[model samples]
Target: MKVLIADDHGIIRLGVSQIIKEIDPGSTIHEAEDFDETIRLLNAHIIDLLILDINIPGGNNFQMISTVKSKQPDIKVLVFSAFSEELYATRYFKAGADGYLQKDTSPVEVKSAVNTILSGKHYMSQNIREYFLQGMIRKEVNMNNPLAELSDRETEVARMLVMGISQTAIAEKLNLHTSTVGTHKYRIFEKLAVSNIAELIEKYRIYDYS
Candidate 1:
């Protein structure tokens, strides 16, 4: 099996790579620390499965799913993120991820999730399944997550802004005008219902930007 693990954390890459080896000793594994590198590796290799961190640099939005599918429509993607399942799993599933695995899940679950996807099936934990169902039965489930309102670019800008990057720097980094960054910042705050950076940080505590 050919597998690519894309995460900015070296430790996460190392640990997941070890898990992949344990799952299949002969598997070819590739690692990338950012979305651009992830895309490059995807283009350069026939990756059977991708273990992706949604918050990796340049991957702060659900649009990443389509981007990956555009490159390799047949490649399976398992989203490995620290975000709450109730809030993000179904959203990613709708975005075309083959599976959703929380970062804090046990190695056994990780192995199971990976193995299931490799077997040409979707994988979602019981908890995620229940959350998905609840969302279906009661539409308010998804509506309650305030962060869901941000668009792709707004999400990227919000994360950078919360990380203490000034609007000008964010513009330079993302190649947008400073005023555009400010607009995104304004919209992010408005959508997330936070008036300041501290509230924004608290709102995104699940992201653990520490």
Candidate 2:
């Protein structure tokens, strides 16, 4: 098996590469520090599985996954993000990622998710699945998801804010301006009835922020 990992964080790349190598000792695992390098590498070689970060430089994880699938539908793509899957998984699946796992996920789960996705099966982590199910259950009974009222882009921005990332980082990750990110955050706060960052995240926590 050939594995390609794309994450700007050097430590993440080294650690995950170690895990992948340990899991499949004979496999060749390559690394790319950004989306551009990732695609550049992929265009030259067919990778069996891609472990991608959501906040890569050239593309947000969602767009990168779509680009990969649209160009090479056979490759398996799994998102490795610090952002919670509940807020992002549906968008990722819609964007054609094969699987989603949180950054804090254990190495065993990472290996299994990659293996399952490569085998042409869905790899929904138990925690992520629970998040999906909770979302479904909320929708089934007409419960209110305050965040649901926001646009997709706004929701993405809001969730990232609650995740405690800096605005500059969010701007960099989303390919938007610092001002634009601020506007989206303002709109998210308006929609969620939050007056400040503390309240915004606190309200998010009240909703069982899994």
Candidate 3:
């Protein structure tokens, strides 16, 4: 297997590389510390799988998945990020990632996720699976869940809000103007029917952003 591990953190790359070796000692592995390097390697190599990080330089959004797939549609992409699975897993999958794995996942789970994706199956955490199952059940009863109504950008902003990030910080992090962040915040409140941050957080906790 030809595998590429793309993460800015060297230790993480080292650790995951070790796990990949344990899974298949003869597997060829490559490391990329940023999006540019990742793309360069992808163009030059016939990678079977890509372990991607969402926050990598020059590729910090859902578009990265499509960009990678556009170059190598056959490459299985496993999104490995520090982002919460509940808020980001579905979005990544929709963006063409073959699997979603949290950065803090145990080595066993990581191995399982890689094996599943390499086998041509999608992978999600148990929590994410439960969330989807519950969403399906809820959809049958009421198709009006606020989280389900959110757009991709809206959901990203909502997750930052729930994480206690100020709108100003979110704007900076997301490369948007402060006013645009405010507009997203207003829309989120309207969609979720919450007037304030406290209500927003409470609702997020209660629903798990399903």
Highest-scoring model, lDDT:
3
| Number of backbone-clashing residue pairs for each candidate, in the order shown | 0, 0, 0
Q: What is candidate 3's lDDT per residue for 27-146, written digit by digit as tens?
A: 999999999999999999999999999878767777788889889989999999986676578778889999999898999999999999999899998987876777752463235445
TM of each candidate vs. truth: 0.82, 0.75, 0.74
Candidate 2 residue-wise lDDT at 37: 92
lDDT of 2: 0.80
Residue-level lDDT of model 2, residues 1-210, one tens digit each, is 899999999999998988888878898888998888998888888889999998776666356777876666798988888765766676787778889898998988988987899889878888657766677724732245676566668866776787787899989988899999999988888888889889988877776345
Model 2 TM-score (2 dp): 0.75
Model with the higher TM-score, candidate 2 or 3: 2
For candidate 1, lDDT tens digit of each residue in 1-210? Answer: 999999999999999999999999999999999999999998899999999999898767777889999999999999999877766676788899999988998999999999999899999998867756766513655366566677657866877777888889888877789998888888998988899999998888854332
Q: Say which prediction, candidate 1 or candidate 2, comes out ahead on TM-score.
A: 1
The per-model lDDT (C-alpha) reads 0.85, 0.80, 0.87
Better of 1 and 3 by lDDT: 3
* Residue 163 lDDT in candidate 3: 76
Best candidate (score: TM-score): 1
